[model samples]
Target: MKPTFIKKGIGFAIASVIAGGSYAETTESPVSKNQQPNVVLIFVDDIGYADMGFQNLRDDIVTPNMDKVAKDGVVFSAGYVTGSVCGPSRAGLVTGRYQQRFGYHDNIGPRVRDKNVEQGLDLSVKTFGNYFQDAGYTTGYIGKSHDGDDKKFWPHNRGFDEFYGFNNGAADYFISGRNVENSEESAHSSIHRNDEVIENFDGYLTDIFGDESVDFIDRHKDSPFFLYVPFNASHGPMQAKHSDLQKFAHISDPLRRKSVAMTYNMDVNVGKIVNKLEQHELMENTMIIFMSDNGGKPDNNGSINSPLRSTKGTTWEGGIRVPFAISYRGHVPANQVIDDPVVSLDILPTTLAIAGIEEKEEWELEGVNLMPRMTGKVDKLESRYLYWLTAARSAIRDENWKLVVPNIHVQNPRYELYKISEDISESNDLSSQYPEQVERLKTEFERWNEYNEDSRWGWNKDRYPYTNGWRGRE
Candidate 1:
């Protein structure tokens, strides 16, 4: 399908006024009477609560482009990632089910060379892209694909028609030849057209991804498409071009300065893609989702999750809570903020629902569609139990109460039950004052645990035992 531009004639004045600008041209793609809207999932890596301009961050970091997305769509003030880390959190997101359900509660097993092993998304579970592809949507994945232990788990095998990104855990933004390996032709920072490795090209990873993403949208503008762009920015091994870092030179903390500048680059790239969609007249029919894999790695990334206790790899609100927004012109509400508890796992089912894919027969999907809640069709999200276990730690959050069993990797028991509503930073523990509430939450956690096969499947080791962190540090 191709879009045609109309030329000015007798009604040229009215047309030009509506167009507003010279490029305000109208184009139409042939639709099959019923076509699903395009879907763009922009998943950012390791970002904190105060990382963006929309989240009321007091920091000097500039993210006006990301803020624009929140302003144009609905931003969820209290959004959580299922896990406190990347691998498991991504597992929860792509599958629309709790990571524990498929024994993906931890990061990919040991990273060893010549292990002759590939780690990635569970080969068995159906991904969001699989459903979209089944329904005839052109699915493309253009960044960070970290699942777990098998080659078949890559995006190409997981149902994406086109895949272009790294398959390993993390790669240096520069010097791609050393880090990346693709099945197709190779490109620098290791470029892979499909499954093959191509030659590396010289450019910023963020910019490369953004440019490729815009081109993908342009190519698939006529057809329904699903674009998954997961940027590995604001994460570890902080690297930013000298020009980007100049903006944050005043910050004494070198890591934080570079991280903040990297964030600005991320924001700029986001603007680039969004503007591309708008220019193509595809914004109205496209659903754009922006969220992070998990919270920030403050120590390494210079991220500050203020009002949030602890940092990434912890169960604290700061660890799991992230900035999330959804924008679909005219369909989703504008400049709205949602406080209802939601998680990244909900994206699959929600996006699938919007794409009109029926997975009602599948019992594995644990997430409910959030589009209704965002659209004001529901007063409040249904009360449901949410559980998170990682690195031997366990946390159960139900309603306004949350129970945290810290330091699960060590011996000696220490527990804190905080009323999150009253203490979002998890400051005060009401466990002693409300023993009954604690017991209730505990029982609920156990019951949820019972339904899963092996939440602690790889927890047999003594170093990171399940009950080690249940007790507090000395």
Candidate 2:
């Protein structure tokens, strides 16, 4: 059954309860003298590299809020997520480690009867929320929580104080339903405020999340808070409000029009949160990081990841590279563009550094602290190798060179290499010319893979097999 849209008054305090197990209240620990800055991590789902105006890809696509974030802070041209898919990328962001290290190699499937094969993040690993909550910061999670489903894997259990979102991967924008009875029609119908289900919601899902985020910031203005807003905009089941759709009627392609509307709506909501921060005078000390969970799935939705090769679900630039920015009013430089490679895993360590929390060896974070580079304390970041692996393919970017090895399971596996710096679109293959470099990168990937555990769930090859005409473009 399609859930009804209840047009209740906006800004109603979202009801909540303790989830998972009980924990000490926020009042239990007083604010530290260090004065940790509030952290807002805004994650947009499946947005393309060229989708926003900040990237200067298309003048038609309006993303004022996102563009403002890039203009006010440092923009990373080579920013990447650990995985090309949603679940694994989110896992890496929350844990600051390669999802592969914890056996999350692919997107988790719908809930199943097998206890051992439950599709969620591993329980033993600690998340960023755990670190922040322990250090006297109130952690609140809004929007999508694709990490897990079991009580133990719930956001509350993983250290979030408040959670207002669904546990599934995707949800419909206009109507709400039950569970993942069907991926498209009924996915994410069941919304939750903490552990309780929210049967009927008033506005669009994007607007509801934005309003809730503003309310959270307003409520927690006294103390430092960590707000994780993972907007499920521009993902699948591409539905947009009639008003938003009207704004982009110029887009002739139906799918493309819907994608633009969805992206635009998310931007407007982001503006709401930013406005609230300014209204509460939290902009100065707050650190805002905006990024996509993964590259756009142009095949699924008509998102344009132009000037990059292929689209989501492949180990190409379009699949991994995403629009990334960090905004801290006085701390980070304004309108600076960084070409150095950085990964989603870096969010944890960087946030900890900003919060004045010392990094401990036990945390085992794989990402680097980007403060020095962003603040001009260091002129250049030391070269580092970034990696991405899925069931069908694997890639490693060392310095400017990138090597992609398609799965041997696929017939006629291809090992292609590109000098990514010179060929941003990955047009030319240098594997035949630089066999030694390919071998070196392959060896490095193997060494890194040695520490990774076997995948908890294998890839679903049959799931999204259609190509959206934008593959292999130079």
Candidate 3:
């Protein structure tokens, strides 16, 4: 269920967290004279591309802090997550590798307990905490850790020095509890600190995550730290604070109002985190990454992935593409926009660079250091084929063209092609019109697909609410 290889740095021993224990750093390099910058990776769940004020898609969407992330730094207009759903997407983001490389092609579900198949990420796979912890930085995870069901795959043992989030995303945002089921759903809905369950909390979960993140920054202000705050806001369960709800009373739709409220509350928390950084004078030295784990599920979360066709759990622009921005004051160029396609996997490598650590060949990382592209050192990002796979569905993006392979079982089953540069909504399928392009992309996808394996724990049909056509019911 795990690999045997160790990622070794050229002249240093890379940090590796033993099964459920800590491994002392073999060679602790002296803290750099320049003081390595801190990293705060804020990951939102099920967010829509057009939901942010920066996207200017909706008049009602209110995300001022998120908009500031774009205004202060760079926004990857063609940003994407590795998976269309949470579990698989996180597997790729955390490990900095495509989830399919290790048979983690779907969201971890009820079948996680199956003895015949292991549903968690392979233990040997290095994560965000591992790299930073090895580099002498304090690491903390403040929100959902949906990597795996097994405790070994949880944040405590995944190299994070401090873990304060729940094991799943279904947990109530408020400790007061929502309509979470009394059975299986409840099991993954409880909040925990480290490995212990915390039965009490003062405020909303998003606020709690923010409070912890701010405190973490304060506690580690003297040293470089990597704080990953994967907020479970605006996801599911449809609950929000009364204060935020009242602000969105102008919106008549009750459900959407709740979502907007939740999102607004989340925006305030982000503002809190940013304020703390500024207070510590760390704003100019820290790298802040804000993005969604995957596209929104409009029906599920009242999210609006406007102008982009399809929703979560499908191979469409709306499912995989997301709102992504990075703010590293005095480092990355200011107020810039990069239209080239980039993925969540790149965050790990970019943060590593911010902390003065370079990727090693043995690490087998799929992401590249984005500094050159963002700093205008390079004319464009090096070309690469970005791919996505889940069960029978797989898609590959090569340059501006995208080819989506339908599950042969779908009615009128055929290959779908779109010049994403022009067809942002994925409304035009030109597979027939561009047969040669389709075949070329198909061949490239096949070659890349050879390295991937089947999902270790089978699939999660819950996420596949969409049908096999252009739209859900089409």
TM-scores, all candidates, are 0.86, 0.87, 0.87
Rank by lDDT, descending?
2, 3, 1
1-474 per-residue lDDT for model 3 (tens digits): 111222121111122222211212232223344788889999998888777766766778777776766677888888999999888999899899998888887776444323455557888789988999999999999999886656798988998999988877566776634322322345556777886766555678888888888799878878888899999988998889998888789999998888888887777788778877776677777888999988999889888886777888888888999988888877787777788889998988888877779789888889878988988899799889999887657788977799987673467557898887766777777887889998899899889889986566543444333223211122
Candidate 3: C-alpha lDDT: 0.78
Count residue pairs with overlapping backbones in model 3. 0
The best candidate by lDDT is 2
Please, what is the whole-model Cα lDDT of each candidate in the order they appear?
Answer: 0.74, 0.80, 0.78
Q: Cα RMSD to native, each candidate?
A: 10.3, 11.2, 11.3
User: Which window of ten consecutive residues has the lowest lDDT sum in model 2?
Assistant: 6-15
What TM-score does structure 2 among the candidates reach? 0.87
The clash tally of candidate 1 reads 32
> In candidate 1, how many Å is residue 432 off?
0.3
Residue runs of model 3 more than 4 Å from their true location after superposition: 1-33, 112-115, 177-185, 408-413, 459-474
Error in Å for residue 338 of model 1: 1.1
lDDT value, candidate 1, whole model: 0.74
